[model samples]
Target: MLDQTDHDDNEPSAPIDMLEAYYAAHNWEFERHDDEIVASIKGSWTTYELRALWRDDDSVLQFLAFPDIKATDDRRPALYEAIGLVNEQLWIGHFELWSSSGILLYRHAALVDGEEEPMLSLSGAELLVESAIEECERFYPVFQFVLWGGKSPREALAAALVETHGEA
Candidate 1:
């Protein structure tokens, strides 16, 4: 638990310390880029680039997960439709298409108020990162189905949403 007394709104501690501690605790390798930390997370579908950054001005922590796939011009329409459907079902974060590059990414953010406890802020950061990664893993297959398997957007989403039964 983080003690409230350990943090002061006027004299807030550096955000990097909390982020580094969390990554170290999880034993996940990461690279620091100025105020951002970048890591690669391997999922069933593919490796995802996870980037976490803190905007001190806004007191917001943002996490983005980019998968190793790109949508072609023709596939953009279907992919966009699937993205909308998937984003609608997501509890946290939303999928976005980079129109310029045709790359898709999942993005989530946590706002940290200076008045709150540092631990609370750190926890929010962790949740944002975890949620982004989880959502990426959950939806990557749908993108793959549409992009490579020639499945319609609706069919790909349905395939991705299918639930399996446990062994009897």
Candidate 2:
């Protein structure tokens, strides 16, 4: 059962329990600490540390997927530029650099009105997690290009954004 804390007028707030169900149904290993669910998901490009936190006060569930990307202080300017270019091409969610930690993560927030059912259903979580992992897989190499391969932000984005139809 989802634990919902009451907000003003005793309306039910967001719940993180759905994510637990999501993990179980997919047979994915995860640990729940308080209002957060942490899981390591393996993608085609790399593994991602996925964290889903529910904020009862705001009735929002936030998804954070880290692709293990890091950048040196000298390359942060380019890293930021690359993130912006990468975010522009995304239809959902966005990428952020936790400059202090030098880590890059993809973040998306789902909002619930807190009047009816839970904000994020188990089915919804399935889509969110899968989509996030796919996004991380698709763009993990772009960050690699900019941070290590000495590729410009625009160049990296252009190269990764290319879509190939039919495998050779």
Candidate 3:
């Protein structure tokens, strides 16, 4: 129940309230990062991720987010969810979903120096893994269903990826 019903584009009060409610239910703390809202959760052994939000030029909503991850040696892009504000318009973003673990790998879009073109770069694997481990500790059931044999589905798939790329 996100409140995107306000007629005034300048006033983003409703959406803010919806986000607050959503996070509160999940036991996350929400904070303001410039013009965006960041939601964070705390854990014992691992650190939680910071989910972020903002508005596009058309008043469409955008989420700069991450999936729960485990610490790995690979340097790869993470998955992110870019849900559309309304039904018609598509909110564009890229992410790699781990079918086994049901974890998402997100790459946040960043402003490159002296470049007009927007860039989506891979976040640090350490951070991503820490976030994922925290999430797994908090929500074990979902992760259990998503992953197989205590590993994300992507791990199983990675073997094939090497063969596909002729690395084998």
Best by lDDT: 2
Q: Rank by TM-score, descending?
A: 2, 1, 3
RMSD (CA, Å), each prediction: 4.4, 6.1, 14.2
Question: TM-scores of all models?
Answer: 0.83, 0.86, 0.34
User: Order of candidates by lDDT, top first?
Assistant: 2, 1, 3
Q: Candidate 3: lDDT of 11?
A: 32
The runs of at least 3 residues in candidate 2 whose Cα sits more than 4 Å from the true structure, single-residue gaps closed, are: 1-14
Minimal lDDT window, size 10, model 3: 79-88
TM-score of predicted model 1? 0.83
Cα deviation of 121, candidate 1, in Å: 4.4
What TM-score should be assigned to candidate 3? 0.34
> Between the candidate structures 1 and 2, which one is better when assessed by TM-score?
2
Candidate 1 collision pairs:
none
Lowest summed lDDT window (length 10), candidate 2: 1-10
Clashing pairs in 2: none
Most TM-score-accurate candidate:
2
